[model samples]
Target: MNSMQNYLADTVKSIPPSGIRRFFDLVTQTKGVISLGVGEPDFVTPWHIREACFYALEKGYTMYTSNSGLLELREEIANYMKKKIGVEYSPQREILITIGVSEAVDLALRALLNPGDEVLVPEPSFVSYAPGTVLAYGKAVSVPTYFEDEYRLKPEVLEKYITPRSKILILAYPNNPTGGIMEKEDLEKLRDLIIKNDLIVISDEIYAELTYNGGHVSIASLPGMRDRTIVLNGFSKAYAMTGWRIGYACGHPDIIAAMTKIHQYTIMCAPIMSQMAAIEALRHGESEMRRMVDDYNNRRKIILSGFKEIGLDCFEPKGAFYAFPSIKISGMSSEEFCEKLLMEEKVAVVPGNAFGANGEGHIRCCYAASIKNIEIAIERMGNFLARHRKG
Candidate 1:
């Protein structure tokens, strides 16, 4: 018999736990540690949304949903996308609700990738894109983003990486860690490139609704892009329903059908009660989202300004709740900075290199934390840097 470890799938062996998980683990062990590491929202799921799920359970709607998702939920998601972001989706054949945006990302890679297919992923973004590509036996080509560019994907950088093997582009905007959003024209350049290059796009847009800037203009909303773009979004960031494990992928009918086929064998369906709750969240939870977005925007300003005053090159994060700040002034490696910040200051943030090779000299701090906590973390960071600054 093969050894216990060797029997695991090669893909399983290739991945690490997560960049942010280790910091939290250390925080758990340390006394008085306050974490700003994880990108999860600090707010609780709205009571009405939770009540809907509980009501479904009380009604015994606990069975497996349709493999794609509940029809009502899919319909609501379609309408929600249209009304909220101007992206029209057909409920019938365009949406497949998976676990979370994480699962949606995985399905997109698996359904489209043959081994060795290269996926160009914008860096210092979400942790999942490259790992999901790796799990699918595809190559995740990391295209680094610099502080000067505010971590937005440059079309020229993407063009430099396109090879015969390059088959997919993973675009994440209103991005994670960096809080960078590619506006309408930025997305258009990518769309033009994809059209000319015959490339498919997997857009992980879980942070869609959390934009401090007015409205989210989806890459999938751009002309000629929807047909080739698999848009990944979920109730996690926007609805504060991370634990619900509910998310959806929308694209052309053929891609949706293929993803549904894979999900059928893997998950069968998401939880019916969660589906019911998600349906309510989409249909009747507009005000809940609005309130949360406003709160997050207020907290965002506090965190960005705090980081700037502390003398970190805090990229003005436009979307999502995290700030990516350079730590070069301290002259410590990203890992060293995080380790020492946790050990000395009892504050936690993830090292940039943890996200990618280009993440050197930087760290990710989540402002999804409470304002008080962000203030405290920022103060601790300032003290730590002040004490460590070399002549």
Candidate 2:
């Protein structure tokens, strides 16, 4: 048998690979490419947080903790949520510490879905949810979000896509790529639909600290919804600790228990040192997060204003570092825009179509990049738009 088409699980073969990684690979191959493609924070992990990991190692905390994770880290995660998000979860039963938000998403989806069940996924979201849904033997029902509504999820939008087979709703806010956020009022609009239809929500709030307009509101915090929402957040975005790979999922005891089983078998636990560092990060990383948020906000303004100046209609991103600007003037598809930008300007931005079909006609730029690069990209974008001026 040819190794070129050796045996592979259908689940692995069925899923499309991440578009972000594709662009990342392309950017890596070409020299002098300044990437605005990556969604990760450019900041280094805080010194104290880094120090905690070293201390943990020194103390020989290299061994695994409990199967779920360290009690201390889970307790800290509980306290962090209670203090900041106005929600409380018991560290023992309600939370399962995970490798990262990525792992939490994977495990949560796998735990909740059965064959042919459907999950309603909001589009222009992070790349993982839809594929993960399919991998769980479920259908991913993508609901197109509108820039006109600021990408908010209204109940009518839900109603149109709802069917008897629908089981879970994967919601990401302070969303990746598009940066859409749903305030309390916006979330309340979906409360009845979610309740009446009995849909479970996997709320991914990885960028909770970066909200510019108002406080981040969890749908789980809304009335009667806490029991059904599996809230996922982590130390990665807030503490600039993506490499640490520590995240937690808090939800119904049944779901948490199911996830813990998967964790026990496949991963055992998150790294011991990372768990130690995660506790300290929750306790002390707030000020560092604030500074990062303020800097990102400044960069956000520069990019959004530049988009307007270049005549692209961009939804005002409320939370995450990405700005998804509509590429109306370039007379090009999102992929075309991105490829041309990288080749001609040596500046790399992710194509919107990579996120979903709903992302066509747009491109996502991460304001987490340096101000100098942001300015240069903006200047180059202006020149790029000028070449294909519609009027």
Candidate 3:
């Protein structure tokens, strides 16, 4: 035991396993558990994109691509970002293809952080931000965003967390777990704050395409922010290409160069076939992406209404596929409520506390499931709540 402890690096050993994956794994062990725990898109990759990959493979395009990925795909990504989000990045120096948003995020942290550097993170949000910062030998300072604020990070709250050592601000919108997004006005607040603090920003926009009603805005598109922000985006959520493991980051040439150095040594390049498919997704997959988003919007309506019918206080999620609702009425901690709900009703939702301490007394339900499944889960939840309240 002593020998094993000595061999393991304390940095790696000190980090805890992902809390979201813990409950997700538990659901897999149980029979007939209706899982709304994972933030995965239920839709499969668009057929044309898959077909393109197959064509690439049959044509013997299996060799490794340039470490920065195929030039053609990066061009398409730049064009897509320009037309869609109003941001322009150089395909040559500012864009680097990655294994996925996960790898892009890790690369961003690794490329930027120095020992004891502070990264300001907004929560309850994605589970990976803080851990990635810690692994890079930086401190993650959580800036709490509340349900009352629609989970949007405010300048006031953010100002309190900034310090002399602060080096980065990690922002993800159309945020995961909470589905909260920062509107243009909301971003203006932080934009001023970022310039004032002179902080680099790691903006994760993986769920940008899943936004409903309102469109997703890129912080990189804001005035004077392009050079200082590393924008991480992927085809997973929007194009239903999660299994393909493809994503990319766009930033200033120096930062992109730094990230690519790590990517080249570690990943070599994203799979050649996946890169081919992503090009198709970027050029011709807009309609398919819209169709999936529309379906999700319908399902979102059903889930939000069902929660209301069950007497839960659910904040209307404007973007992403999650619905975060308070379970305070059940008089149980989020973990207890989720476990009992799964054990009794066979429905699996994530305990909100898994996201952060501010997420306590709540639970996250992914609405990416089929409408029938969502309806059934909500019905079972109603019964579970009724029973628990009576006791």
Candidate 4:
């Protein structure tokens, strides 16, 4: 087996396993752990959406959808995008359904990058962006966004990272780990820079519907960006449909065609039943989705208050269901803090560095868990911190 390892592709060997999953494996081994690690919604997929899938199955709609996905779903996505972001997309030519935003990310990178092209990824981001760049034969460049800026990517900072080799910029706001969001004005600042550099953007708006402060904004809606930006979104976060494995990408027809070529060969189409469920979600699921978002907002307030009471400085997260609080006060690295808290208090949270180096001094506490579990976890964490506080 040691000799066989030599035959592995260098690209595959170069990438490390997801740090988030590695630590969560330890959580699985521990009993009675209150987990605040995974970013998935705690709510069940709304009953109406599930019923739609069941009805589709009863009607014998289990066959493969077109490689671009069910036309109905794509049309619904088009309407949703137009209403949500004021952007128009041709469902036939510009939208391709994918196996989750995960697959959409991979497909976009694989279709867009050439060997040695640089992908500028704003850090403390979702864990997959860097590795996805590597897998696509691109160089992943980290563009650090400070907590002081509420983790929004700044135009001046982004300009410093651009070089002749930078080809793509990934925008994942309502971001993972940090729960940061980019408002319309923040994105407006980057518009000229993006156009000046001739770089394309992969805007992952998977959490678009979860924003609490105001409406979610897509760069694609900005002037001159519609043609250069690929928008990725899905039913996972908002609809609590993570297991459904359905997402879609909207971009220029040329880019969409390229992505579809790769997706057709690799994934074919998202599950047909899931596609059926998604159509119902877009048409009639907004009320339940809003109710869930309202619930998350309440949980968000409680967790932020809990961290403040514990003497951890946590920024207010305006979107997404996470609270990132600095753990430096405990005088332990993020890993040390998380591991000790889990072992001593049976509360599981992810170390920040798992997302990127900029995350080293903080810890990501997902508010997606129940309010009861979140409260208990916070109390446990406070106890653990008091015992472990350095003089």
Q: Count the backbone clashes (under 3 Å) in each candidate.
A: 0, 0, 0, 0
Each model's lDDT comes to: 0.87, 0.89, 0.93, 0.94
Tens-place lDDT digits, model 3, residues 227-338:
9999999999989888999999999999999999999888899999999999999989999999999999999999999999999999999998999999999999999999
Clashes of 4: 0
**Residue 305 error for model 1, in Å?**
1.8
State the displacement of the C-alpha of residue 20, model 4, in Å, after optimal TM-score superposition.
Answer: 1.1
Q: Candidate 2, 79: how far from true, in Å? A: 1.0
lDDT by residue for model 2 over 1-391, one digit each (tens)? 5585457887888888888998899899999887889887889998999999899889988897898899988888888888777888989999999999999999998898899999998888889889988888999999988898889887888799999999999889998888889988989999999999999999999999889998898899988999999999988887889898988899989999999998889999899999999888888888888998999999999999988888888988999899998886777888888888888878889999889999999999998988988898898888877886566
Task: lDDT winner between 2 and 4, please give it.
Answer: 4
Model 2 RMSD in angstroms: 1.2
lDDT-superior candidate, 1 or 3: 3
User: Against the correct fold, how does model 1 do in TM-score?
Assistant: 0.96
> Which 10-residue window in model 1 sums to the lowest lDDT?
80-89
RMSD of 3: 1.2
For residue 331, give model 2's deviation from the true position in Å: 1.3
Using TM-score as the measure, which candidate wins? 4
Better of 3 and 4 by TM-score: 4
- TM-scores for all predictions: 0.96, 0.97, 0.98, 0.99
